[model samples]
Target: MCKKVFILFAIFSFLLFSVVMGNWQVAPSSAEYEYSAGDSFTVALTLNGDGNDIDALGFDLTYPGSLLNFRRAYFEGTLLDSWMFKQTQLLSEGVLRIAGFTISGAINSGTAGKLINLVFEVKATASDEGYIFPNSFTDDLAGATGDTAIFRVKPLGYSVIGYIWYFSNHLPVPNVSISLANYLNTTSTSGEFSFDLIPEGDYVIKPEKINDIGGSVSPFDASYILRYAVGLTQLSPSQLIAGDVSGNGSVSPFDASYILQYSVGLIESFPVSRDWFFLPSEFPLDDANWNSAPDSISLSPLDSDTSGLDFKGIVMGDVTGNWNGGLKKQTAAFVSYRIEAPHQLSQTKIEIPLKLNFNQATLAWLVKVRYQAVGSKFLSAEVLGKSENCIFVSHEKNGIINLAFASPEPLGNQQIMVSLYFEKENSLSDKFPKIEICKARLNETLAQIINLRENDEFQASSFQLLQNYPNPFNPETLIEFSLKKQGYTTLQIYNTAGQLIKTLISGPMDAGNHQSLWDGRDEIGNLVASGIYFYKLKSAEFHLVKKMLLVR
Candidate 1:
């Protein structure tokens, strides 16, 4: 009887080991398929066990969150009804109807491998598009846990090209990566890449990831691809040599000398000139009409020189205001001057009734004041209610003196007016301390303009081949590096065969550091035969090589 019991115990131990060891394994181990835009692909999941009854195997998969253009999905099986899309919370299998059949559902437990399947509709976006499938199991094992699987749906027929531009004098941010899905192309340190050609369509271009610094990545870095037209054509010299800015067929000095008479006060207009009716000097200078007149000092024509500037307003605005254009002798004579348009204001003047409140404010009594927005196009100011006044002052193209009100504390229900006094050839410091009063209402103005100089200040460098993380990597590891500039770069893996085994990136990189997850797989996704693999980085100016090991 004791011998019989020992044999039964051994049999039970063997069965238990088998169930644990063979608990879960995905079929194909890895899947590879190419799809065009608006196309579909199929993937299967099979079980390996001694009749491990699985009522349901649910999956919660996410694409490269920023990459895939998620549309709809479906699954197959008796548990197809159990598949729920968490975001929309809709049953994926039911709503996904393509062709004569709904391509997604669950399989019957009896059918086993025959029942578990999925269909995905591909989007015609751009190169390097893909999706990841993560799965979970729901079975009679009760307390058992399941592992997830990842599957990729690659795009077909597309090429990817990377663009990189890095300039110094800007913030030196290197190590950036640009990825294109359909072409399966990623940029390295060189900032150059070529992808497989695919169908043309709009691609969502965004900085996939940002540098370690808190600075935001550039959105303008994104771009769309335009496919080739049916055919191409060339233009003749007459058609090509248009726009006679310098006129010779091409317009140049001869045309300008001939048209100089039209300039200045000599003639009303010129024949060759198409648009000049909007000149500022042509109109009687007034603060209200400033936005309409084109001037030499503004950004439109982008004048680098400003010599003689002057403006005489009959009456500046809703408030009684005046100025003599020059900065040395500025003037401000107003109970108040209110800004209009761009936005609206309720006050036009500041009335000083009775004695002024000197406890919390400083008032200035002036003969006159002027406002000007000279050599610039924006108006931003902070006004003071009581103490701490910070105002932006500038000279205007029309010779008006502009004042931007600024203050530290909030001005509630107070309408305060800043008055400036201008006298002939008189400097601001030489003017009288004007007695200014107000009902303290702070109107703050801030403009969001492109600081080209600042924008150009922070330039990214190319992606670099940093030392691989976990250097003597086992079967898995990570590679990291920074791109100090922009341009084409490459990260290639070479086996002992001296042949290129895999390409981690072969494209343009933005300036910043980036990391790639490498599993020591060859180009064919086969576990590279255990040995040594060298990764090389080649860019326009940088060449680096690093060695890594693969242990079986």
Candidate 2:
């Protein structure tokens, strides 16, 4: 009986070995796997046989050329005695060994019929054309089988991509969709996708998504943005101030405005997509009044009483600019007026001592003027009464009305010269009337400010992305570029096959000239192959793609 029992035990041990043996097996899920060029993946590893525990079991991964890359590795077990294992074989310094692995007893230990798993990951080459990389494993113990996983990388090429965070503060949206149309072509999967082969043509990228639910559809965020990947010849001005319809750097507002004119056609640049812009809160300006129209009150240098002439409580009509009065004295007239708070300017008579040539004069009408703030705020007055300029604030304390009735040459129109010396000594003492231009005419005032704008055009000092002096970039390359505004940006590298080979920076950056260096490897420290490569710049609104050659 003793002999028979021993035989059974021996047989059982052999069978267990057989089960765990025979070339370690993988999911076989896809003999070949395709992945996002710039994305990372996590996959599971399985063994065919069942064994409580297998000792002296490990894997050795090798890399042929600087082409393939390795990042990290892990070993799964159920041992209570925690221990960290150092990496024995590494292709390059880039290989990160995740050591010191100790599994809790919750799992089966050696001698049990449980399976153990070893996980690992590797990065792809930095080239456009996909490279076939094979991951092979070798088990020290004879019973376990060796396994390998294959991967194929995709590329993003000249297409630049970005996302818009569009969510309403009021509602809870489970899943949101941000889509793009028009000049920017996009393809999305359940997961991430890549954009490649973009031309230099201008395009409009607007966000379109469903809100709350599919049934409750709404417009995209007002502050939509686009990810741009400019290719080859970088657009002179890295930014498109207004009409960046294509989202690329070019003054293509003409395209956007044209699309607006052709209402019959599909609206390409309208803010309708999610990825095109951020939520409304992302807007940087003051929310004071993006919708309301200000009130406009008419003023005739003729009416001088506070009774019927006191225009208040009425909203202003859009101020219409009148050139009939000549450019020298252009007038913007409003129909309604509202008294901004209640305050009155001191009634006084003002006169001009000196007669001078006139260049420009702006006249406004209002109800009551606060006297507290003189030069800072506007002061109101009645017109045409005993005080030729009664409503007008007279700064001159003594010389209110210097009436010199002498020259008959300019006689028909009483040579009434008004002067006020209040601005010099009491700079901030005088109050200016609050003139709310017609809501419709608000744009006119803003335009006037523009017409008076000083030339502040920016000239980007450099254009071409200067290559790192020495051809085979040793450790790094000093990259330099200039920007007008600070924004989130990304600098990356891609191989000929269009795959994302490396990422130099991925974060919001400030405006002004910038310089970054690439160590010629990918996110993984593995060295890259020598060849023609491309680098791209991405921002909330700027996308530029430039090429570089890496000679191995």
Best candidate, lDDT:
1
Candidate 2 lDDT by residue in tens digits, 226-332:
11222322221111222233334343334334324323345523341222222222233223332221212122221121122110110011011111101122334
Candidate 2 matches the true fold with a TM-score of: 0.22
Whole-model Cα lDDT per candidate?
Answer: 0.38, 0.35
Q: What residue runs in model 1 are displaced by over 4 Å at the alpha carbon?
A: 1-14, 17-30, 36-49, 56-63, 69-111, 116-126, 129-138, 141-552
TM-score of each: 0.21, 0.22
lDDT of 1 by residue, 1-552 (tens): 999999999999988865643344334223555555566655453444433444444333333433334454344452333444212232242221111112344332233332245455655445454434434323333233333344343444444343332221112112333333333443343334344443445442221223232211111111000010112333222211211212233323343333343333354333433321112222354434433333222212211222222111111010111111111221221223332212112122121111111112323321112222222222323233436354444333333234434445543324553333223232222222222111121231111111111122223344456566455777566666667877798888898678999898989876654445566776644567788888888789888888888777
TM-score leader: 2
After superposition, the stretches of candidate 2 with alpha carbons farther than 4 Å from their true spots are 1-31, 62-68, 74-88, 92-140, 157-196, 199-552
